[model samples]
Target chain A: MRMIPAYPVRSVLVLLAPCLVLSLWLGMPSLVHPATPEEIGLKIATEASARDDGFGNFTATQAMVLRNKQGQESRRQLRVKVLEVTDDGDKSLMVFDEPRDVKGTALLTHAHKQEADDQWLYLPALKRVKRISSSNRSGSFMGSEFSYEDLSAPEVEKYTYRYLRDEPCGKLTCTVCERFPVDKKASGYSRQVVWQDKDELRTWKVEYYDRKDSHLKTLTIGNYTQHLDRYWRAGEMTMVNHLTGKSTVLNWAAYQFRTKLKERDFSKTGLKRAR
Target chain B: MRDGAARYALALTTIWLAASVLAVEAHAEIEFAAWELSGRVSLESRYFPRTGIDPSHQSSNTNGFVLEPKLYVEDVEGRSVTVLPFFRYDSADPVRTHWDLREAYVLLFGELGENEWEVRLGADRVFWGVTESQHLVDIVNQIDFLEHPNGKVKLGQPMVHVTWTADWGVLEFFGLPYHRPRIFPGQGGRLRFAGLLDNERVEYQSGAEEWHPDFAARYSHSFGPLDIGVSVFDGTSREATLVCVPPACNPREISDLSNVLIPYYAQIRQFGLDAQLTLGAWLFKLEAMHRSGERNALGLQQESNATELRGIGFEDILGLYREEEYVAAVVGGEYTFYSVFGSTADIGLLAEWNYDERGRQALPRRQPLTLDNDFFFGALLAFNDVESTEIKVAFLTDASRATRTLAAEFDRRLSDQWSLHVESSSILSMDPDDIQWVGRRDSFFEFHLEYNF
Candidate 1:
């Protein structure tokens, strides 16, 4: 119950209150300068996808360290090659390189935008290539916390987006958005919440909601480095499966962009020979 | 003699290990694309709590070891050569000690017509069926009897494979040149009959015997949710028909004879269709086959046992009265419930109903030496963690015999390269008269420690 100065102070405060309220309300939404929330989400997603175009192909080596609730750890190393397809989704091949039981194991993927992706697994022990059912994509990847759907590259057409909010996440201003998977039959998730920075349009964090609408996993990306001065690739990505009390950390190194990768390299014929 | 073979196998494994290590060291400075060596060595112990029916296996506890050394070499053009030599030594069963060249082949893969055609030429092992309990349609490789009773292991088959992939689907052809024979237990093995199977008595319907030519063709395609594969094979049957000495034979002659069962390989043709549909977490599968000239020379119907010979004693050679054609089918499904009982582990339940048209087992259990209609149910709880711990439980029941075979397995990864496994299996039959059949074998518990290198 502190009393205001009657004449000058009250009049000045009353005059500036509406202007301050209007500025606060209008300042946040107009930062990115989009028309609607959905528009903003689509625009951001499109920008992210567009910003990553014209890299041709890339090859990367990664180390995956898995840990359980008891702090027990296991490690695996693999090489990944991705080819950019203009009309359809990308074609990628992953070859395992460590832990003798699974050494020389490989997976080749031909992702499509509309239909289920075709995937083949070459088990070194069996010495044959096996085609896995795309609809049965909920199995763990190499017994890790990551599922097959989680390891796949997320395409722009794979999800429908809606903007949630704008907030400052750590140092960067991030736009929170919700996305629903387009292929409801194959994807194990019902929806996902993504946080991408406004400056680089790179994903900072994501929360996965499982088919049962339960919060299942959380993925955080960090230590990003710009490749070819345009494409942003995260150096470290950690995925924590909340329900399972297990986590997988992927540390990527030696990313070579614009590598000469052909369609033959991703075919099933080359799966067993991949290294 | 067993000790000598064991020592020789051990020395061979040691020599291969040393040579692989030396080769790796020699190529240390060069790029690793030239060659890579990887393999596994496991030591296993089996303990039978119950006294075995077979007096030959008097020792309840036994120890064994297996060394599988595999080498993969790649040329600059991506053509690869895989050499895997497997050796196992089991002290309890002298016949189980053996060595095999599991894989020694050069795989040449190529694509033509703008990726529309692909060919794979090599000696390899191929598994064709999708069922978890039994593989009803797999016939490419001979069953490795010592590996497991469930027929999950195989011996390599020399073959050429070619596939044509187009907008319609994939059409594949296989030409099998070398047909290998299945090995049965030699005298001292468990789960075998009172006497050993005399390989000398092996008769092939085709006069060519083991050198018969086999060929297979398959067409696979996907129509929406359903994936289908239709296959046809012309070859000697992998399933062997038993030729036994009549029970009326004199004890002196029986004592003189070493064979309680003689494998008769029949020349047959098989047409099969395998289909699977996946919708959400449910998987429905079916496998159907019709065999022409199946058991055309067999003696029994697989369900009846006669203490008295049908029309003759030991004077007449026992053979099928006429040519027979039969069909078999298996229909099953798997339903998975994720986060079952509010836990992170997933539980899957599978059911399979197998029907054999030639099998007639509606009456009481008088067991013969062939297969019959049955049902199987299996469950798997996978704890996908850093350890990848899992437990599998399954049971197969023959209603006519009122007997069941139950199995349970637990596997745990101790470390990145180390693992421990325990498995138990038992057979229980309702009919006391069915004591002398396949499922009547004594139960066993197997434990193993494996180290992957």
Candidate 2:
């Protein structure tokens, strides 16, 4: 202390105090080392979400193809309209177009950040709107391998994330992480391992673990296309069930953005008016 | 008379079509799409294990075929037209072999400055209620009884419906012009009464008869977790009160007293409220209604006091068309277990309590059939398989009447365009003194195969 200059020592400690506080706030291991796994995982997820902000609204068509263990195939088609909410989760209206039996059925959902979503169903045969419980998120969607929870928009508040490692995913370097659902009592999975590309933070694949920590299913997303030069969307998503040897493939088409959709377009009345 | 009613309906439809065409022509430069055609055909087979209480009604098996075709067109100007025609042919029951226009409507919906509005002019179906066991607030459409004993089917109602959406709630107003008479089973039909119902001698409390104009209004809104609706209806009652005039049923004689029951329609005013609250995995539903101007059991005594027709001691069928008031309610909840036992399937347990002020003493069809002071418990199993399979089983019991019924319904998709449905109901035990004792031998199993395009 006597050998060093007093002014230099005072200035260095003054600057290092804020850094030390910020590092601790961010849960970093040390100043010389990288951030802790939790910080890195959150950073990746937050950045990935930031990349998809301010889309306004969109409309798309999806054809779901389901295949059983014996190679039997069933098909369903639906049209989806989405509206972005500034301070909350998005709102969506999905209307079935194929599977003639339920042709005019529509589902409307208003997702929330820290609470259960609000859902309503329009039954064309009854010409009535029914408010449905959203707690059945783990149940299969339209008998497909994809559950309702899997199809919903993933908000950062719904899960807790942890970083695993950085590894090579195909030709691109990727960050592997794990996330546990916030609603542990309602979720069917204990945790999910995700692989996301480093450059654009595009999710490449996901593996789901059941409550008992057994591998349950794997989801692979491919054919990424960028819209508006800012948003990356997957054209194909395949979910395979390991326990039942069944799989469902969702083929998306006609991706449109900024469709001038309003909040009233996602209301209960809108559900009945959907074609 | 039936033919005349059909002609009147056709004339009204033609006039509406002409008016809509003129309206469309007034809108310049709006292109409409070509008419699209779609619909379904169904083949059904129903079997009864026990013979009917009436010896003459001996048909234990029957076959039916249905054809429903739809035509639709829409324009970019928020205008659309839908036409659906339905026809069915029953092998055993002549009344079941009938045809009707299920839907034929012109819908125009758009925004008015800051508000949204929709107008639908023509025949349509509107259903309102939250409870599953009994739809107390659903008073818009007339039930198609001959289509199913469960009364799930409805005939198209001719109306001019308008809906206005505001920041507060949605307000819907309906102007219904015509009433569809409830159809009954023929003598050969399994679910028919002890004798044939003479529809040719139908009576109405309103002098306007079947031509009486009806009005209904509903206001619905949704809060954070609750959706509620309040409705008011002023119209002819859909359920007919049967008046046995002369030569009433003798307790000793079990047959040959036909054409004595006259179906009477009453003008009524009904106020209803339905609400559903969703919390976590639980859904609570309530539907309550207060209706006036329908006959009750007490009216039977009033009839004997005023009319020349003496009461034949058949208290169930001899109620006079007197103005009476009553209240009914169905309160229930459903709790669902998602992915139980580590499977993708879901199971829901449902329980409902049905209450009627008139209780069991009220005549049949005055309130919900078989639901006066009753408890219903049910379980729904959704396989969530590739076939979209589902099964629902329910149990209904009335302690006062000592009656019990068990029913099961199953449906699955055979393919994208094909489906199959099966339903069975069994009356395990019933009190002979109960009004519904005639249905003791009415247990049946039904199968339906449908093809859609």
Candidate 3:
């Protein structure tokens, strides 16, 4: 009702329409220029880590099956408890249950961001606790395809990342990225390539390259389940060694989150009673 | 009388089995879930390629079987109980065929003002040492030498153990009430000394004898790359002094009584320090101890316990020892090469030096003197494979006396519940003056197959 002149209204529309069109074009996924590959890679990793943060603590039981080229299989069972640390890497305790010869053996690890981790092994037969050298990160874990480094909690500071490309993965689009390990001397691999979903940032697959830059192994993760309405956890992981014609499959079950685990429970003194 | 006692034991065992069966039937599901039963059974075969020097014990082959059953029970309130019994039957050695209560203990865990505490009651085995070449600080349990000459097996000791964990370190205190005597090989056994050694011919310096109360305490802590422990023990010495009582007093007398060896236990106070430093792929270990109130070297005109010998002047007569204080130490290091030759197997080299101030006069003269003023070199191969295989070889030698020992051991899992072990050792002595020359031909090989459930 207050409009006075049609010429003023036409001039206002002409000035605002170009600005709206320009903003829409810039926001378009196909036309927009993304941030740098390194920045994007870090951003994705950080987001993925943040989503799984604040879990406080969790416990899970794992069963591993190892197969050789001759199709012979061996099995191992273990129970793991993890405690989340707000300022540092998480703490974990693993107790073996199979291969009855070492039924009550347990391993405790205290991970750090920029320094070597602290590890201890409890031998039930001897009732002795021994501190293991953390420099053997590349050594096989329980004679499986997974190395100690592969099984450790993936802390963002332990690697340098760069975004490679995005591709279709399974039923969804995934962002591909490459990461270089920070501890070159201890790590068996020079670099690893990861494929993660764009929506929830859950990792789907990874390829490991040996120090000589040859593809050494491939790990595929699947059967993701949501916990606490926000956190996603993989139920199964399979690792295959290309050079050795060997493979190991890990099946995780009975996951309980936020079980009110205390820091004192993860101490080296508690290792003997971990059973 | 022995048959009557055996009958009585059989009846008691039958009653216990009946009661256990009744209890299981009464609380089938409730108790079954809380109680866990598991253990190992092993079959072993041994062969001696070389004949021993003792003509009386000339057996070159032997076999044995061992059974160990364990029962564990835990409650939700941080209380648990464990019971394990061990039994072995040897085909040729009577002294090696024995039964023992390996462990029967109740453990209680609790927290006190942010500090954790634990208490253990009953019989248990506690080992404390970082060095592999010698366990100088491990004195809580008596060695079961009759089982193996390498001295790795131990007898359970009755003790009241308490552990307290604080921010500074872990403190452990033990009150041991019973002392188990070391049993020597029988006449039918292979690794026997040149004597008619009998367990009945044992003496103790303390009047209280095997009932003497023993005490030990240890404080252990870890700081980054280093882990250290300081321990003190006041108890009867585990090593028995070999004494030859008169009329076996004279060294030149070839009398029948001279062939008998008496084991004498002495009271001792030992202070021990053990430490290990782990850097990269290297591990450095050291164990040192200073002991008092135990006899040292043999000397002339020494006081003897034999009343007949006391009347004469030369009481030393190879039967007397003078009590003195001495220090012993073992230091070693191991360097590992992981992922060797682009393979998953890891190889490690180890070297250790053992020093004892008493030298060749170390009280346990009847046993091999491999750790006194000797150097040990060893290699360990760990094959990180599905079978979890490992091989270890060690060589120990005394440069001055020319006494050497070469040993090798290999073990691997044959299946999920079965495993195999093979061990061999050879000894060489060039110095006839060395006591080790008595059994220079005691080289042997052992094979073991174990099943676990």
Candidate 4:
């Protein structure tokens, strides 16, 4: 067998070294320039917000059961109407139907992407409309565990997020993340941790921490169903307040999408006529 | 009870029964399914710590019950009608054993000139004011004075109201064709100007009397955080100050010195403006009014003929009979603190200044300045529990008069259809500068039970 001279082989290797190094340097950016955790979180949020667009309008009925620490429970029933708003978040109206004392009570909310939302409460007894202050958004809703802020649809710009990790959540794999409210004064919670399933990118659970940074509440969402083959909504949501040992369960049913509701249907006049 | 009263009772019962049946039936033809029937039954008992001002008081206490039944019907085409009847009975006073059709109206809405237009025709009540302490600017409804001293109750006014809604503001035009006489305590009632109001001696500035054709217009709009309202009223004043030949308050009662207070309804033109500014957790409110022809007892005395003024104890009932023009305003605000007491409760502090530039009242001498010029401070605490319990305390004081009025109430819902309310009130007065509550100035505790359906 004939062998090339060792010196010649060495010379060729020397000639190729610089070229290999140059090639690797040119390809490094594509593999190493991964998105930051924040960028990934924002991407997920933006995707989620965009996914539910074009629903136009929808209506649904809900039943809420509130349980105090002593295990005593009371139930309330209401109907909700929602209208998709462009250049903003969404508009919604809630009218209570049962619990005679509060019947004919209605609430109107106009959510915004970058500003505090607008809210109005119509109490039948007074036959008047009262506007809720923006700073008071964190107050309890109708004496329930939920708050006025919680009733509003989540907007992408209202929060800053950090992607935490991927983990198994029930039957699906979820992308976990942490969110800090952009306007602290309007939120009762200092921070929140949420888990969103990867398949449909729908939120499955959220953990809220009070201003003191202690765990205050846990919200679990389940029984999700899709409408218009695109929009997804949970049929059941349960919120348990660890600090108070109280829990509220909301069960939504009979969701009707693309109801052709117009802006007029969400006006103050509509609120007064909600019955 | 009179025959007419009994007839009204029977008719109301039958009507309510039919409405209940319709509300239960699902017949789409008659549109019964679209009608809603609702009502309330309440039993309230008042215990006075002392005998009331009723110089003729037979009892120091009172037990009352009210049945308010309402029905709303909507046609398939969207036109709607509402009927609300309020029936109340009081054991202590015959004047309060009455029933009123608080609201019976038909509403229609449509679009006109790119603006949504709505009109209501029939007997209805319209309130216009921003003050929590008094309804100074609410002049549309004839006050039900016999019900409560603070003037919250009202008698329905028959009128046609048209509202034009635009993005900029809401413009309302009102045509009140008939006037309803204000109710006052009878001879045997606890609170009375004299012994009773002379129902037959009432006078009206308008020649049309109770059939006066009154009109008003209003414009209201909101800009960002501020809401503003401007209104003009030209009509017979719903507020009737009285004139007596010799006041029932006079120590020496005369056979010719009529004990009856004669109501005088003045014709006037009024301009009003109300504004509210919304800030984070705070709301600021202001209400102002300018009137041209309000009756002033002092002004009247200055114009009275010598014979009419002879031997009259004018100073004792000073501001009761004159007519004057003036301006008035009320300014206040409410501040709320969230999550009070480490619970899901919110506490709200409210303060208000009620000022009548003239510092006037009917029969000012006897009326004093008890509530005319006062500072009102109140607090409301709300619990976010399942029952949504709440407690409110309010105090009104006029430092000059050295008089004060305190009102407190506690409310809680026992169930979906039952509720309990406990309320208490007292007015303190002193000397020749007597408070109008006078003999009726007893501390009152009320226990109220209600059922809603």
Candidate 5:
């Protein structure tokens, strides 16, 4: 009767306790030792920043194919020319290439906390550059399944996150996190839970929820390949709207970075003369 | 007019001959035009069991077809024009009559000074309401009352119209001189006319007829996301009736004419303002109108004619002057939910309240309560890339009764160029006591194959 249990819970705790303490200590480089979730999140954020800094600038060509349940299909091709990156891991201007009709389309994201991002679209048919209001970012982009909010650059400040667990995604270990959108007016989703590779920082999947707190859409990124010396980009991204029964797929290829693109290339005046 | 037609034909012949002579030289120039053809065929079969008035059973089946062909010619020497023509054939029964018509016209658009203008000289669909499915006051088309119970209005007359569009608004003027009557053929092969002057008891004088021109103006402005429009138009009367006609021995001689009295020279003048505003997920609309009819001269004439017919004095049929005015206002709103229950389920609720002032002399002064509520809920499910399903439910409630309709459709994409659709609709009423249903009660099913080019 005095024999120990086959799986001793006390021994398991003893083995995990020291490793947890050491992880906490390493996670908080700013401190000697820490145990809070925020400290680990900061460490993860720092690592993400470091990885983004190594990527510098990027330019790529992408093709998007959309298919409905009725076998209706639509395809579009776009060329992305990114200009600059900051130490905070923010991309400056990402320009488009052929089709010549949208050659001048550029997206500039000002990542900041407690403020809305400013955006603009230059329409060749109207021959005018119009400022896109921030309130409608959740609307569909050109009647596509992808929302304008999804197309915009994802800023860390736009969401508050909490690391959930370590899970296996394919052959790699992933960090699962639940993120809530800070700006209610700019997003139709109340929150999103995403899985990203721990070492590569490549996003694998995300589950989106509507304002009513219901599951709405799911996005999956796959077939990631190293674009530049340090940059890892996904070759295919698929987004599915659960309610609408619609899906959009984006396939990316031919990526290049840091070709000495100038700020003048992203100017409003230059946009009119892009083609 | 006959001589003018001959002259025009001769001139067209000369132009054709000249164009043929120059065809060889112009053969090197390649010209291309966009052409489109669309057609629709509808067949309906109905069986009504004996109810109330009818002792024996009655059933009817009808078939109709419409073909529309459009040719758009643009950038021809830097000019643009579009020609669209439509043909329709409708038959209800084998022994019943068949109606056919060529419906359409071409439009030539050009710039006059700084404003854009268009001249349309043939039968065409006129633009009036923003919502074509349900029109509150549009009265242009003479529709088949039996086939389309909701469309009791008349169609627009054939007219040559000129429209001018500017930054301010649009103005149109129509010149209509001829009145075409609808003819209905009975089983006995006798043709009967349907119009104001269709009765043989009336006589219409020749030279007394005059062309009536209708003029309308509309102005619209956009304030933020809201669009507001105000329109005014003049109501024109054109048809004249004859009371009676006597037999004539000589074919060329004029027959004996009976005294005719045209009923009420009703001239209706109307003005309306409509506004549509969108705020967030809600759409709000408001419409107000004031219609007044004056000059009851035809009523006076009818009284005098009746007195004469009865061999009475004019004083006996006096007291027939009763003018009427109508004022109505409606406000409606619709709210749409973009997402519901983690699905693309959209729900729209609409409520419209209308207040109308019935004519003072018209019967049924109680004026049925014009308040109505409509609700719609739709859901779409995509099973895969080749098949989809959609379901929609609509509920309409008025002061008289409440009706509910449910529709479901499944679409299967067979190929890149073809798709198959199956749809069904069912309707039911809320109140069993108010069961004088004029429309179809049984569900309807449709199978369609659609091809896109």
Candidate 6:
């Protein structure tokens, strides 16, 4: 207003010159060459495997809906409480909310590479918990369209992967990768191919093959929403059976991770009387 | 002499032709067979005071045992086949001749144009229901309640059947006319034919037994995270027509003759719906059924003295009567969880409600009334894998003054194929005023060693 910044403007410009130069110098390497599809795909896979939420313990509530091609639908409300989630691994319990009476029942899984994962389901009606075998993981979970194999957290070591190519996916370029199941006896699929966004490393689609090498199903994940600045998760996953013409869609809501929880909260004594 | 020789030569030629035909039929070979064997046993003990208030003056003891074995074999040659089978059983007490030949039969399978078909002349479990539980449906083996009451057990008989399968569905026709020791009269001694269709979204079956033609259909779909299904059936069973009617000349005497015997002339209808959903860490399931029927013989039992005094009129008295209608419904669900505190733990909860009503055309003056109302709840918790060691407890109540039962069970897997199981059930009458001590008692226990192959 009073010609106050004439002297200050030059001085500020002089001060910004070095900072601008430094930024340009620092960004020069990335700008010179974009990441190739293979490099980008590997980077995404590695990053997802290495991510740690730092909650040590946490809990989440979710509403799940399954829709079929015929437009029929079913819904359930679920709560998962995490007791110990370290950079190395995690342990958690889950329970159902609706139909009112079975609200407090829970399931626990302890996963380790050296041994078969230990799993158990707590039933309120029986007031007893039953151990489930790892071999039985492929069976239907409570008669839902999703099998137990679909619900369990997939450990990165469960499969081995190789980058395939760059593929145009919708309006964006995506890196495609092929994954083969490492444990042939334990897996339901012989191999799977996944497509991920080149820039963000978000997985967008996957195709699974049966043991006979026949294409079995295709799954598409969408509706990405950012959480906690660096976290992104899909809100919907649709799977279609190639041979049977049956399809299932999973709609998820209220996904959260990283809250302070403890091992004591997931104990047998705790399960018998969980609220 | 020349005439006799010519006749002998003709007979020899006929025998040779028949032998060749038999040989060709026997050599048309495609054979299939499978066998399944399962068994369970447990030990139990109980304590009850002579008086309701006296806890100290009580008595308790325990014992249990069981054994079961099953086998099946089939032979198919070209268009013809045969089957043989057997089952062995021992439970709680020892009995003579535990082994019984359960099935024996022959069949023919072939292809006509692009369609595949089969004709079977033997015995097999008739198809019915998405899930089998004798408590709810029929065609059961009468196994102990521990096993799935909803599973269909193979019961053998003499039958002739034809089946055709295509991309759209399957159609079948059958006739069974025989008898068995433990089966109801109409069930074992009747002719039956049925048709079935199975596709990705739906399944249906329809058939005629000696007394009725039955029809059933089920449709399923997925929505969001849940799977849902609906099923309906008509004319449930041939055995449902056992109610005797009084003779025209003698209203007081029960007549053995049936007034309505044509298939589907009288019918029973049932509808069911079920859903399963998973949200987060919880799994939810709901199952329900609504059934209504005409001329239901199973509900025509004679009223006991106590039931009669409970406002049941003289016209409602048992012998040889007809009911125009009846209705029943049940709903239930279960939830389960596994592992707490990093230890191998499992748990679950279940609840169900059942209601039944019977209309009164035979009850003289009283209108249709509620026959029974039942509510059931159960909870299960296990600490270790049953393969190593496990324990469980369950409670059930019938709110309509029938009976309440409390049970506990433990199982140990001694080895890869061997296991030890123990269980006990305690029954209590809600109305203490009408206690029948002998058959309806304090507790029952069982013990068993099971092996799998």
Candidate 3's error at B360, in angstroms?
0.8
Clashing pairs in 3: none
CA deviation > 4 Å runs, candidate 5: A1-187, A191-238, A241-246, A249-275, B1-33, B38-58, B76-121, B130-134, B139-147, B152-211, B237-267, B293-323, B359-453
* Candidates, DockQ: 0.25, 0.66, 0.60, 0.40, 0.03, 0.02
Docking class of 1: acceptable
Q: Provide the clashing-pair count of each candidate structure.
A: 0, 0, 0, 10, 17, 72
True contacts kept of 2: 0.83
Model 4 agreement with the true structure over A147-180: per-residue lDDT tens digits: 8767678788989999999999888999998888
Which of 3 and 5 is ahead in lDDT?
A: 3
Candidate 5's DockQ: 0.03
Tens-digit per-residue lDDT, B144-217, candidate 4:
66666667777666677888788888888999877777666665556553235666566787899877899999
- Tens-place lDDT per residue, model 2, B1-453, is 144545666667667767876887897665886567878899998898998766575488899999998888887665788988788888988777887777888888778877788888888888898987767789888877778766668888888899988778899999988887777777677776324566666777788998899999999999889999999999898877766555643222223334445667788899999999999999999999999987653224333545444544334344444567999889999999887786778899999998888776555342224577888899999988878799999888885777888889999999999999999978778776554455578778999999988
Candidate 3 local lDDT, A1-275, one digit each (tens): 66778879889989988986865654343356656787678777877888888999999999999999898999999999999999788999999988888888999998988888888898877777888788889999989999999999789988889999999998899999998888899789999999999999999999999999999999999998898998888899999999989999999999999885677678767787776
RMSD in angstroms, candidate 4? 8.3
True contacts kept of each: 0.35, 0.83, 0.68, 0.51, 0.00, 0.00
Residue A99 of model 3, lDDT score = 82
Candidate 2 similarity to native, TM-score: 0.91
Residue-by-residue lDDT tens digits, candidate 1, A212-242: 9999999999999989998999999999999
lDDT of 6 by residue, A1-275 (tens): 76977879988989998987875655444566765444444555776655535435556665655444565555556777765455434666878653233344688766644345556567643334444445444444432345566666556666677778888999999988887767776666788898887767787898888778998778898998776666666778777767655566666676665543445345433343343
Ranking by lDDT: 2, 3, 4, 1, 5, 6
Clashing residue pairs, candidate 1?
Answer: none
- Residues B310-365 of candidate 5 have per-residue lDDT tens digits of 34322232234445566655677666554345343334455555444642112111
Interface RMSD measured for model 5: 10.9
| Model 6 clash number | 72
lDDT of 3 by residue, B300-370 (tens): 22244333454443234433577789999999999999999999999999999988888766633224554
Assign candidate 4 its CAPRI class: acceptable
Top lDDT prediction, candidate number: 2
Candidate 6: tens digits of C-alpha lDDT, residues B1-453: 112222332343344335534664577644444332322222222232222221132123213332333233334332323233333332211221133323333444555665556555544334322210112332211211112111223334344555654433345454434322222112111100100001011101123322233444544443434545565655433222322222211112222122211112234566656555544334455555555554433223333322423444323433323534454444565555644443335566666665555422211000011114556566666553313366766555556555565667787655445567677656555433211211233354656665533
- Candidate order by TM-score, highest to lowest? 2, 3, 4, 1, 5, 6
